[model samples]
Target: MRTVRFSAVAAVTAAALTAVTACTAKSDAEDGTAIQVTAADSTCETSTTTVPAGHVTLKIENKGSKATEVEIVFPDDRIVAEKENIGPGTKYRLTAEVKAGEYEIACRPGMKGHGVRQKLTVTGGTTVKRDPKLDKAVADYRAYVQEQADETLPRVETFAKAIKDGDLEAAKKAYAISRLGWERTEPVAESFGDIDPKVDVRADGLEPGQKWTGWHRLEKALWADKKIGAEEKTLADRLVTDLKDWQKRVGTAEITPTSMANGAKELLDEVATGKVTGEEDRYAHTDLVDFKGNVEGAQKAYELLKPVAAKNDPALAQELDRQFAALDKLLDTYRSDKTSYDFVSYDKVGKDDRKELSDAVNALAEPLSKLAAAVVK
Candidate 1:
């Protein structure tokens, strides 16, 4: 649908920057029970902005000409439920079970700016205890993220040392290997303040007057600028130190099923938005490597929640499996006899091929986005 996705840094940083599945009370409503939210070019109007706290559903209809999205934002700005790329004349049903509290409904028409908003007061629903099975699933994912961090941080130390030692070849080889860990756990990583920007900021994401640093900076020095001097070495060292700090924080971080599902979608969004455009690993032309890592990570996260998703919506889960397999098939075409992908420069991809990749990603993202709400039920 060509959904306009603002960068996560700009769109969601103020919020806790995590997507959480709401523990809404288990209840079924009549077919017409959902509130009708109409998203137009300049306004977001709803049938009713007030509702009982548990198990609220919004039948969001995008009436605007442009692609639009709807978000149910918690008091802390965390997104409890969201539907992206609701193209004109299309409608999507977003359900969430939240505590009795005030929330905001943010509608992004044309996928730009802070979306038009309305106060959504959720009141008078009984509080439901957190589910033990969901908690167990969350803990397992956290452990997986921690394991990835443990493995990745040490390799990054080596990558930084290689750069410091003026071993550009060694550093270049290590670059792809090290990123494997980071991409898998990026959703959880984004929660740790400062670490995400320090470790993975793209040049465009930098604030005015901010010098570029981290992996991309080193990538430019190694491949494009062809100079790995003191400045680049310093950046590499700082990245390693930050990664170590990030590893320490992983154990203490909280992961919810919703966050994991959305994280998977977020990684693919990276592929659809920047990586495919060659904006991410510009110098190295290694966007394919990152793309693969994102897909793997997303796949793993979804797999963890597969049981719950199946229980709630078996058809949706089956469709997701089919879509993932399709995307995986497309990605597999890029591999070569060498351990690494035999990817040409992004500029070299044929238009038809590019469209195919985009289509596959969008296909996966569509069904995948529905998983967050399904599992929480």
Candidate 2:
């Protein structure tokens, strides 16, 4: 029984608090010695307990006095479970097994404020109940890839138009313009593990004469050292390849709508789990810093999720459409207001950041998540 001081984000009593929906339900366990982690500031309380490696039950109840959540992390660096704002006077549950190792437990009000933390000690356990939902996750991810293949062509055309029309600088900027978007999509790509070689495009890291798969390829072109060249042939080649593939349906030879939606879902999952990286080269952002990474992440979410619209169920489709509308507004506003993003300059973001626009981009993740759940189901 060691008590350690865990630094959690504190909530500002005077600050305005927005209503937050639960990100996921609480996990279950066998010990039943479930402890409730409560927020000293707000009357928010969450059910908690020790996680013994293997199968266990964790009942994270939102005492409903205020919005709250609990995050269960594992030694494997897996965010095994997360229970967010269960609602006042209401509760949500998730049943999951734990694995042996060091773990970090974080229970907070939302992404903004102070919460609670405890170390979960687990030796091991023998329970092998895997959720079938994960299988659907795989299928859902593939569908996302298809969606990207389906939609990126148009954007590629827009990009090509900018390039062919003598906007070489625009062309360079556009190369990795979608790198963040692609990075967001990569996690889902990883889960597929073995993509259909004939259908799924390979981004097998940069190699000689190898074509680029997603947005990062373009980013490479933009940042490459030119050897006395009038134009970046590599960057132009990728655009051409991408645009052509879009037209001819490369990698998407047999993609179903569900698979595409799943892929989009997987990308969003990466963002929530922080599995997504910000940028490859720190200096890469010299041209466009923080804004590009976030903006691209947001844009990729939108671009990759759109096609699945036609394939989603009625309810899911409607939600996706709604999210798209809001996100579109955010992107439009962001583009028009360059002052909002510090991409072109080293200016720090002010209190009135363009996060509204950025959040709009990130927000699509929710609907997309719903869409992914439905697609996988």
Scored by lDDT, the top model is 1
Q: Model 2 over residues 1-377: C-alpha lDDT tens digits? A: 00111223223342433222222233332332244444432433334334445544444565545555555554322345544434555554333334566665555553223344456665555434434443343355456556655555565556555555656566555444433333434433332222211112323422234334333333444445422133444444455574454434334332333334434444444333321232333224432332344334434443444444345456666766777666545444434364433243213323244345446546766666444334322
lDDT of every model, 2 decimals: 0.73, 0.42
Off by over 4 Å in 2: 1-170, 173-252, 267-322, 337-363, 373-377
Write down the RMSD of all candidates, one decimal each.
6.2, 14.1
The local lDDT score (0 to 100) that residue 272 gets in candidate 1 is 83
Q: Model 1 misses residue 234 by how many Å?
A: 1.2
Global lDDT of model 2: 0.42
For candidate 1, give the lDDT of residue 123.
77
lDDT of 1 by residue, 35-150 (tens): 66788877787766667755567778888898887877654445566666678999877655556788787787765445677777787756445467667777888889989999
TM-score, structure 2 vs. true: 0.35
Q: What TM-score do all the candidates reach, one by one? A: 0.73, 0.35
